[model samples]
Each structure stands twice: as C-alpha cells, then as structure tokens.
Target: MPNKPSLTTPPANDPSLDNLGHPAIPFPSSANPPVQTEPVVEKTAEIMQPASEKLTALRAQAGSKLRSETDQAIRKLGAHSEKLYVSQAKLLDNCHSQLRKQPMIFLGLAVATAVAVSVLLHRQMR
Candidate 1:
C-alpha cells in the first residue's frame, strides 16, 4: 500500500507560497528607498518645451494663412457684386432707351398680354 502525504508539512524549496496554498506577501527590507524621479521629469519637460513652442508657431502661421484667404475671398465677392451692379444698371439704361424710342409698341404688347392672361383665367374658372 502507498503512504499518504501529511497535510501539516510545508515544501522546502519554494519561498513564494505559504502553507495554506496562497501566495506569500513580501516585506520591504530597506527603511527609506530613493524616489529617483527628478531627472526623468526634467528630461520630459526639456523635450516638451520645444514641441510646445513649435506648436504655437504652427498655429499662428495657419491663422495668418486663413485670414489672408478669407480676405481674398471677400475681395472677390465685392468685385463680383460690383460687376453685377454695373451690368444691371446698363441693362436698365438700355431698357429705358428702347421704351422711350418706341412707347406705343410696348403699350400695345402690354394690353395684348393682359387680354391673354384674362382669357386664360376665365377659361380656368369655367
């Protein structure tokens, strides 16, 4: 017959496990350990400072470019509006000249258009 192992005995080789099959908690040996954080923090700050300055400069350059583009667009709109206004004024002048030269023809056409519209409306009502 084979013998059974005793439950009360602990294994000798492994120090990480306790007798109850749970992991052992580690205790710190040194009284005061050094933090050693200042050099890393200073290096990070030194790297980030140049990056931040470049970012600020890039933002300013983009803003100036956008402002110039906006100004150019506004100027183009103003020029187009002026051209439209001048063409409209010329059209109005030509219409006025034609009307002055031949008033009776325009009056007859107007009467004919009114008669045609009224006849269409009367037909629709029926």
Candidate 2:
C-alpha cells in the first residue's frame, strides 16, 4: 500500500505559507506593549449608562401614558354609562306617568296580551 499525503500540512515552497509553514497571520508577541483594558471598560460603561437611563425613562413615560389613557377611557365609559342610566330612569318615569294617567287602559291591554300569549301556548301544545 502507498502512503497518502496529509491534508493538514501545506505544500513546501508555497507563497502563502510563511517560513515557519504557518499562515501569515500577525500575532501579539512580547515585543508589543500590553493593551490597556481599563479604558475600554470605562468607555463601554460610559456609553451604556445613558442608554440604560434613557430606556428606564422611556419605560416610565410609556407606563404613565398608558395609565393616563386608561383612566381617561374609564372616565369616558363611566360618563356614558351615567348618561344611559339617566335616560333609562327618564324612560321609566315616563312609562310610570303614562300608566298612572290611564290605569284602566293599560290593565285592559295587559289582559289582552296575556290571553293572546295563552292562546299561542295552547296552540303550540296541540
């Protein structure tokens, strides 16, 4: 059996490969000065703090707006319901006044309605 060439090793004298036969990527060595991380962390915190505050303020503003709108809607509904109640009371008062003015007429009408309903029920049973 013949030996197969490995896929992991690059070909010799390849232009893309460095003298060490590794890809030509620059890596940090002891020669370069160490990168300072504290400034980056402070800058990130400085950038995020205002954004967090703005988000919290916006949330509170939206909640306040929603509460105010809900209260306004409830007040409007309550006012409409109050109007409906007043109108219903007025209608009942008018009906009572009419019945008082003509008790005998309403009584006759009631008896006729009762007789008509009984006749309908009796016919349905048959």
Candidate 3:
C-alpha cells in the first residue's frame, strides 16, 4: 500500500485559505466599494434638529422653574427659622422673669428635684 495525504490535513499554499487554514469568505474588494454615508447622516441630523432644539428649550425652562421654586422654599424656611428664634427668646425671657420674681421658690424646687433624681439613681443602682 502507498502512503496517501490524509483528508484532515489541508492543502498548503491554498489561495482561498486564511492564515489559520479556514476558507475565507469573499469580501468587498477594489471591484465593489462601499457607498457614501455622509448624505444619509446629514438627512438624519436634519430630521432630529427640531426635536433637539425643543428638548434644549424645555431643559432651560425646567431649570429656571426649579431655581425659582427652590428660592421660594428657602425663603419660607428662613421665615420659619426667624419666627422660631423669636418665640424661643420670648420663652426664655418669661422664664427668667418668673425666676427673678420668686428666687426662694425656684431654689427650693431645684434642690427638691436634685434630691429626687439622686434617690431614683440610687434605687436603679441596686
């Protein structure tokens, strides 16, 4: 029997074979070139221009509205903070006047409160 070439081994120097020995699919070569794409791109841009402009205008309007609403909310919070400070100051002044009017009563109440707290603490420690 004579030694024959195996079917598993591809033929060497085959023009149709790629570097890895697989058959290469035919691609567009110098004979058939790709079509120009610039006109298609320009048409698409023209179609989208109106929507793009509307989107930009909407964005600017929304930003301005948001800033105005934020400023209104900040002003409201500032007013509330000022009112709270005034109320708190008035409460402190009232308490001071009451303490000064009856110093003996306030001193007695403070001592009694301290004694009660100490007794409660001593009980919890046990």
Candidate 4:
C-alpha cells in the first residue's frame, strides 16, 4: 500500500514536527525559567507571577518617561518665549536708535508747526 498523506498530525518519528505540529518545539513557558524548572502542576502560577511583575516594571518606566517628556517640552517652551522677548527688545532698541539719529528732523518739524499755530492764534486774537 502507498503512504497516505496526513493533514493534522505529523508522523510520530518525523524529526521536523512535534506532536502538536508546532515547529519541532513549543514556545518556552515562563514557568520554567532557564535557571530552574517547575513541576508541571506549578507551571501556571509560576508563569502568571513573572508576567505580573514585568507589567508592573513597565508601568513604572512608562510613568517616568512621561514625566521626562513633559519637563523637556516645558523647557523648550521657555526657551522659545525668551527668544521672542529678546527679539522684541532688539526691535524696540533699533527704533529708538533711528529716532535718536534723526532728532534734528523731528525737532524742526515740531517747531515749525508750533510757530505757525501761534501766529494764527495771535491774528485771531487781534
């Protein structure tokens, strides 16, 4: 008779596939830490304990990471605000310098307008 093709289970002696058909071996169980092996009956509790501990550690790390991110963002905002303030101060300084350089022009225009108004007021009074 010819060998029949199998679908679910591999041949018992097949070197490639385990009984469960999962690539020769199953994934490692957390219960049997590489350091020591637990009895089959104690595997479930051993696996659960490690998973919970890892989760707690991850949570603490996540909190610390979030706090660090917030602090960095605040520092960046403060730096940008300081830069904006400095820019405004520089602009105002430039305006004051230009006004100082052209003082004569402004003074002349002010005196002329004042003199003309005074003359008109005197004529009106008379």
Candidate 5:
C-alpha cells in the first residue's frame, strides 16, 4: 500500500513552513519600513510657498494694470464730455441767434408743435 501525505504536514521544500509544519508568520521587513511623512509634508510646503508668492505678485500686477486702464477710460470720457459740452454750447448760441432774427417764425413753429402734441395725447386717451 502507498503512503498518502496528511493535510497537517507541509512539503519539505516550502520555506514558509515552520519545523512544526505550520505556516510561518511573516514579520515586517526593517529595510523597507513604512515611510515617515514629515519630510514629504515639509517638501510640499516648500514647493507651495514660491507658488503663493508668485500668485500675490501676479495679483498686484493685474490690479495696477486694471487701475491704469480705468484711469485712461475716465480721461477719455472726460475729454468726450468736454467736447460734447462745447458743441452743445455752440449749438445753443446758434439757436439763440436764429430765434432773435426770426421771432415770428419760432412762435409759429412752437404753436404747431403744441397742437401736434395735444392731438397725439387726445388720440392716446381715446
């Protein structure tokens, strides 16, 4: 009769088996221990510091540029408004001269405008 190996006995060539034929419990290796995270945290902070400073500098530059552009726009608006004021004053002076030269014609035009507005308002109410 042939001999059959029992389940409790490990093969002789298995290094993971103890002298008692039980599986050997493996201990953590000292050469490859869990990494200490302090260095990584410090390195991350060091990298981010330069980025934060750059962001602040960029924000300052953007703010200065925006302020300069806004000042230019305000100056342009002021110049345009001055030009419009001068043109309007000239137009008013011309109108005044024309009215003084032809008082009767201006009075007739004013009466006609009033009559047209009254007729429009009366139709709107109806």
Candidate 6:
C-alpha cells in the first residue's frame, strides 16, 4: 500500500464547484424529530379559504335579486295609482253630463205649479 491517510484531516478539496465560487447545498437530515402539528391543519386552511370566497359571492347575488324584486313592486304600485285617478275623474264627468242633459225637465215642472196657483185664486174671487 502507498500509505494510509490520517483520519484527523478532511479531503484535500471538494469535488464540485460553481463559477460563482459557492458550495452546493448538502442533503437534508432524515433522522430529525417529528413535527408537533398534524398535517390536517394546513390542509384545512387551504380548503376553508376557497369556501369563504364562494359564500361571499353567493351573498352578493342574493342581494342583487332582492333589489330587483323591490324595484318591480314599486313600479306596479305606481301603475295602480294612475289607474285610480283616471277612474275618479270619469265618475265625476258622468255626473256633470247627467245634470246638463235634464235642464228642460226641471223648468217645465216649475211653470206648471205656478199656473195652477193663479187659476185657483181667480175662481175664489168670483
């Protein structure tokens, strides 16, 4: 044998080197202590985030639907109010026409009563 090397010293130099002059990363330790937390905690947070976002979207949709329904109801009420006004005006107009058409009937009744009273007074004087 050529000669056995001393155990105290490391190898003469590393085999791999980069142009930037930094050493590569070494392998991670496999025999480290177990993590304190369960893996489910991280997974639950990932699952919950998307669900909350979807819930907010649904709430916005419902609010918009409610507003649309309320607007329609208001429009219907306004249409009914206009209809009521037109009906009242028609009723008043009909009453006025009836009074104008019967003016001659009223005058004839008044003249007949006055003539009857005059004749009765002349007979009594005789």
Against the hidden reference, what TM-scores do the models get? 0.62, 0.59, 0.73, 0.41, 0.64, 0.43
lDDT of 5 by residue, 1-126 (tens): 899877786676687743333346443347536667999999999999999999999999999999999999999999999999999999999999999999999999999999999999999999
lDDT of 1 at 75: 100
Candidate 3 stretches with Cα past 4 Å from truth are 1-31
lDDT by candidate, in order shown: 0.86, 0.88, 0.88, 0.83, 0.88, 0.78
Model 1, range 2-119, lDDT digits (tens) per residue?
Answer: 9988887566556654233434644332653555799999999999999999999999999999999999999999999999999999999999999999999999999999999999
Q: Which predicted model would earn the best TM-score? A: 3
Residue 75 lDDT in model 4? 100
lDDT score at residue 116, model 1, on the 0-100 scale: 100
Which candidate, 3 or 4, would have the higher TM-score against the true structure?
A: 3
User: Pairing residues by index, what is the TM-score of model 1?
Assistant: 0.62
Against the true structure, candidate 2 has what lDDT?
A: 0.88
Which parts of model 1 are misplaced by more than 4 Å? 1-43
Cα-based lDDT at residue 57, candidate 4:
100
* lDDT accuracy of residue 22 in candidate 2: 41
Candidate 1: worst-modelled 10 consecutive residues by lDDT? 20-29
lDDT of 2 by residue, 6-117 (tens): 7886676576653343446443447645578999999999999999999999999999999999999999999999999999999999999999999999999999999999
Tell me the tens digit of each residue's lDDT in model 6 across 1-126.
698878874454554422234346433236534455667788888889999899999999999999999999999999999999999999989867866899777578779988999999989999
Model 5 clash pairs?
none
Considering TM-score, which of the candidate structures 3 and 6 is the better prediction for this target? Answer: 3
lDDT tens string, model 4, 9-91? 66667866323547656544474335444576488777799898999999999999999999999999999999999999999
Candidate 2 residue spans exceeding 4 A from truth:
2-47
What global local distance difference test value does model 6 have? Answer: 0.78
